[model samples]
Target chain A: MKKHILTGTLTALLTLGGLSVPALAGPEDVVVENAWSRASIGMNRPGAAYMTISNTGDEPVTLIGLATPLAMMPEIHETKTNAEGVSSMSPAGEIVIAPGESIALEPGGLHAMLMRLQEPMTEGDTFPLTLLFDDGGEVTVEVPILSIAARGPED
Target chain B: MQRRAILGYGAAGAGAVALMLFVGWWQVDGPGGPEPIGQRPVALTAMDFRLTDHEGNVVGPETLIGRPTMAFFGFTYCPDVCPTTLSDISGWLDDLGDEADEMNVVFITVDPERDTVETMAEYVGYFHPAIRGWTGPEEQIARVADGFRATYVRVPTESGDYTMNHTASVFLFAASGRFVTMIDYHEPREFAVPKIRRALEEETEGAT
Candidate 1:
């Protein structure tokens, strides 16, 4: 009974406080670089996060999940534009990263879609994000918020 | 004998239809066919329609005329395309150097349900300083969309959430509010910058 109560309290606090998860633990094969998100305009607005994901491991790995406390829901999505210049977004599932290959989650392409934003991603703010791998390994890291108009870090 | 006669008539009818179609196509093609995408301005002159700008001012097509304009249709909820296209426009404006002052870019929301005037202001605030966002009642927005031949719809997802899928092209207009051409979404800086320069020149030429 005591354990259940403690866990419940912790979950509630995490959700209410918008607590970012603790830093990633040891032994991560996937290196996440330059994880950043553009500042959202208002509360409850949607936002996007981008980063470069590199696979240093010898074997291939597939990304299966993502989580963030800043958003009520997080999803992996990709935007595609046709020849006629119409754009559509679709859920991207199981993105496989080949060994020695790097995949970019950038603007106008694959991205982490943050829905029902719980907090404003203001400039100079930072948040925690967790990525789950199909092999049961997870990477938790800090995403430094950038200006809303930023096209890249240089901007 | 009757079957043979019927067959002959059918062949004659088919020949007649084929000749008519060839003549019709020759008339429509007009020598070298229709003009290229970036050349002729189609005069897509937008009809006057009321809309609330990000600055809370009531505006219409007439309010935006007399300047080289680029009309873009999108929503704030768009994650990748909208921001990317906005960034793309910013780059073109940057390349335009001092001439950028003579151009106007308008962002009209197709998802007015969520994109209020306040939100529209906040969203466009991220792009180039010259870009402005507009939003209004659904019927008014629909009229403007019809004027530009743009399309957008709220698409429902499997998870019960929704997204706004919209035309991603940037509609270019001359100083006279005549439709010039378009810079398709994700168009390379090299392709868009030249066309923009020419359009600005056209605006200047028309002015003097």
Candidate 2:
């Protein structure tokens, strides 16, 4: 039962990685590293996933989708603030990775919102996740879940 | 010989009971619980505002009154401060165990344009479910922010994304909703948990 719940939560967070294909797929390269989920305890519903993405190709590549067996749906998302002094989170259409550059999806910034957990995420658990890019290429990664208290602001 | 043995057993039992009581009392009054802020006492003032939770419920100061409340002002879009702070609160609550039941945790959105009741709820839900989220109309939110002395400003970027710069502090209120102290953003566990323990103990003692 616990395993099912953890899987469900990861599925919800990974659901955001899916996006429409971009017009130009300049480079065929994308790499994700250090992807992990924020640790939480009982009755906690949603969590955030963080990682670093590196584009090693000569041309820029866009990350469009993410997938994992843990969720029902996944979509690309970004946090944006409006003029009325309100901050909101919405689906990111595409995340562009420049050539030889890396984007850090750390806390307080662009992160994967793992929504609608099937189970509570305890500390010391790991979930398997996959990142899908526009050029039909994908990377499989393991996200370690840690205690919410252990996560620092910079992480 | 039998009578002497009974007396000895009675003495041992009494000693054991006394030791247990001492340990229990020490744990309750230990240094790890909430402590009073030695500096200026934070004043809790009431402000009326409208905001929503992830489940789309209306929330304001009134919702925080029944229990000792720990409130923080932040936006869901904050890249670093908001999530880390809230995550710390969640961890502290876990460490608190049953003590959390007597406290109400609140996350107030400074940016209400995007943080409708539903959005606030969704955002807050990422943390512990016991934490309540509130955000209302812009004017009302502004009033509440001012009352708490929390600050927020929006800066625009070329990519069509904007960032909000705001003060990050957790405010603790008595069960009666009087301001207690502000937990600095960086050391919530070290600073905030002890204050919460102190508040709960004080409330319990007062009731007795």
Candidate 3:
């Protein structure tokens, strides 16, 4: 009887603290959502993945790199267009997310460039991706491959 | 008296229908629609450069002159923008249906170092069958880009590799080899198809 009461009290305390459900959800403080990629055009072509990373904890976290079995080298890249409407892509450095903030990796902006894809990423395919953090921790996400003309996760 | 009242309502209804028709025409052809930036067509003959197509045939601006042309500059390595644009072009062509055969669509490479003839051939094959991939010497690419007033630059990445920065607009030209207008990147198909149709119509009228 006492053990049961103690367990009930602990659950009540956790619920009152507003950390019961979400705290038990994942071990990492960062949350990755809407991970998606477009289908590869053809063989020997590269691919890209986009997602939104949210730092749910009170401390800031840094995203250092990415990894996937599908690509030879998965790197964070960003596409920037100039004032004259010239677009370019370059490797992106470490991304820092403050507590309660979210960083969106989207089209025409920061994204994961999958270099030298092992095979063509076909539509209706899903793959696992790992996001390496600065503190040696990582988060794994499932990325879904959409149509080549897909503009976002919703598509 | 009731019959006259009914006739009066019918007359008002017809007048309203006519007004709506006029308003619709005004929206389509008036200042609301897309307007050509340049009043005069820029002659493609003014530019002279040679590049090889994906099929390994040497082609110059003269080859593009006889048909309504839609040209874009991008590299095969481009993952997001280039592929998306190519897919959008395919959708546009699909929307055009049989009329697509009346146009010349070309994909010019800004990164000549990586996009060889073979690479371009494989890359373009994934898109609309009508698209012709072109690549050649860097200087010749520059010559063609200058003729179109398009710009490109090489940008180095942190990984010691490089990428290209180039104009994102698709240039449209009439069969007379004259510049008609530019279709901005990510422009919706509803607007893009009409621009292409206008270019094609310009050619058809010229032929007549």
Candidate 4:
């Protein structure tokens, strides 16, 4: 009787383990690469984040939203230069990436405007950025903060 | 015939009024508009200015006018635009070689509240050795920006914080203190090198 009871309990434990593994949601097929941002100056100062988003799979993806714990609000902003070379910055909605392609968000183009820092960002410090996609994919990327005038991570 | 004459006079009077309005608008709003980018469309009459540099010494038109000078208006907090432009300027100076000595690059802060003299000094040093940075009273900075016909507006964010939208063009002045031309905000070195070489050559030609 004792041997039979132990076998039944072992079977039940294996079944529960199989069920719990599927409960954890995995990140959808998307890759975020080379994320970096300039360090903010003070509490009320605004800093910018730049990165390259690649759609590695055959299916296209659209980036819908961005959130960060470091800033009060994070949104997509594009800097446009007119034919006369006058630049204007405004909020950009969503950006779509085709299959096997990537979109680079850099200066004078699409970028993430991190607004109103909760605290000063120091060099070498990093923060978490959650990128929301149309495929119900949420990818968290670690963006390392560089100096006040850092053009890129290599700098 | 009387009605025809009245109509003709009325049309001519209306045309005259339209022409007058366009001229008035162009003077304050068109040619000298808030943000004049690219090679300056017209030669801007240089205005004399008195302000301090990073060294705390008083610098004015009297001190700065004698050499070929380049003035850029931007804030320190500007990560991408300002640094990219400054880096490009550094490249221009590097391309100038010894001709660089004849030209001076100065960075003036549009956001004076944060871009103190110390800030400007540190920021400018990152690019090139000869670059100078300046900041002063808000009115003084405005006067200098106005003198160049540049525009900079404060843009408020969602959290009541603000960022600056400033004129990113680089202004070039001749040794005569007259506006020579503006190197479009981010003109490549190939495009900028020739224009700057010609300007430097002209200074030499004028001196001889």
* Highest-DockQ candidate: 1
Worst 10 residues of 3 chain A by lDDT: A18-27
What is the TM-score (0 to 1) of candidate 2?
0.51
Per-residue C-alpha lDDT of model 3 across residues B75-124, encoded as one tens digit per residue: 98788778767877888899999999989999999999999999999888
* Residue A24 Cα positional deviation in candidate 2, in Å, after optimal superposition: 30
Residue B107 displacement in candidate 4 (angstroms):
1.1
Cα shift from native, residue B43, model 4 (Å): 6.6
lDDT of 4 by residue, B59-171 (tens): 76656656877788888776567766776777788778888988867888988898888877766766778788888888988788767767788887565656678777787
Query: lDDT per residue, candidate 2, A1-155, as tens digits?
Result: 45434543544345334221211112335566566676643432345677778887798777887776554444445654333223445566688888999987766457765554556666666665666677766665566676554464233
lDDT of 2 by residue, B1-208 (tens): 9999999999999999998888776667656433422233234435666666657776667777757878888877554467777777888898899999888888888778877776676667678777888777888878777677666777653335565666666778777667777676545366678987877776666567
Candidate 3 residue spans exceeding 4 A from truth:
A1-33, A39-45, A54-62, A96-103, A116-125, A134-137, A146-155, B1-42
Give the docking tier of candidate 4: acceptable
Every prediction: chain A TM-score: 0.81, 0.69, 0.82, 0.79
Tens-digit per-residue lDDT, A28-85, candidate 4 = 4566666778776566567788888777778788899888888888888887666654
Error of 2 at B96 (Å): 0.8
DockQ of each model against the real complex?
0.42, 0.10, 0.27, 0.28
Better of 2 and 4 by TM-score: 4
- Candidates ranked by DockQ: 1, 4, 3, 2
Flag regions of model 1 displaced more than 4 Å. Answer: A1-28, B1-48, B158-160
What local lDDT does model 2 show for residue A98? 84
Q: Alpha carbon lDDT of residue B178, candidate 4?
A: 65
**Model 2 residue A13 lDDT score:** 48
- Clashing pairs for model 1 are none
| Model 4: pairs clashing at backbone N, Cα or C within 3 Å | none
